[model samples]
Target: MRESDLIYILAMAGVTYLVRMLPLVLLKKEIKNRFLRSFLYYVPYACLAAMTVPAVFFATTYVLGAAVGFFVALFLSYREKSLLVVALAACAAVFVAERLIQWIA
Candidate 1:
């Protein structure tokens, strides 16, 4: 809306890009240490769990509904395990649940 807000947003965007790019630019070489590389492998799972577990419970029943959808997706994707299928299942579950609730209330 204002010039100050635009400058602040641009500055933040630049900072975020620099922070993310710095790691890739710096770690261009393959890590030699086996232990460290092994540890790095868990980083994605750990970060996702850390971010999601708390939010799942803190948020609404949507999380539980998503869990149901995840299972459904898992089953539907049992042979191929496609990400698209999983995402569709989760979104469909949300939409159906909301509509069902509205009809009931």
Candidate 2:
């Protein structure tokens, strides 16, 4: 790799590291506010959903398969299934949907 490319990558790595690390280092006291604590507790799940939802819609060739998978996942999740079960159910739903689509077409 070029020197400039190495420098740019290092700079990006440093910035990303600092952005994540500074928060923990600066906030030494335990959070006391109930509302803030609750919000913080759910932040990771919220972030995960935000990141994964869009990808789910576009992950397959056909929108129908993706939609089927999404609804299966949503239903299993609402029913409080284990994470592994929910994931496998969604994958199976998508696979079946895709095969059905292929057979029909």
TM-scores for all candidates? 0.75, 0.75
**Which parts of model 1 are misplaced by more than 4 Å?**
56-64, 74-80
Residue range 21-57, candidate 1, lDDT tens digits: 9999999999989999999999998997798665644
Error of 2 at 92 (Å): 2.3
Computed on alpha carbons, the lDDT of every model, listed in order, comes to: 0.74, 0.95
Per-residue lDDT of model 2, residues 1-105, tens digit only: 899999999999999999999999999999999999999999999999998878889998898999999999999999999999999999999999999999999
Scanning candidate 2 in windows of ten residues, the lowest lDDT window is 52-61
**Model 2 error, position 12 (Å):** 2.1
Query: Which residue pairs collide, candidate 2?
Result: none
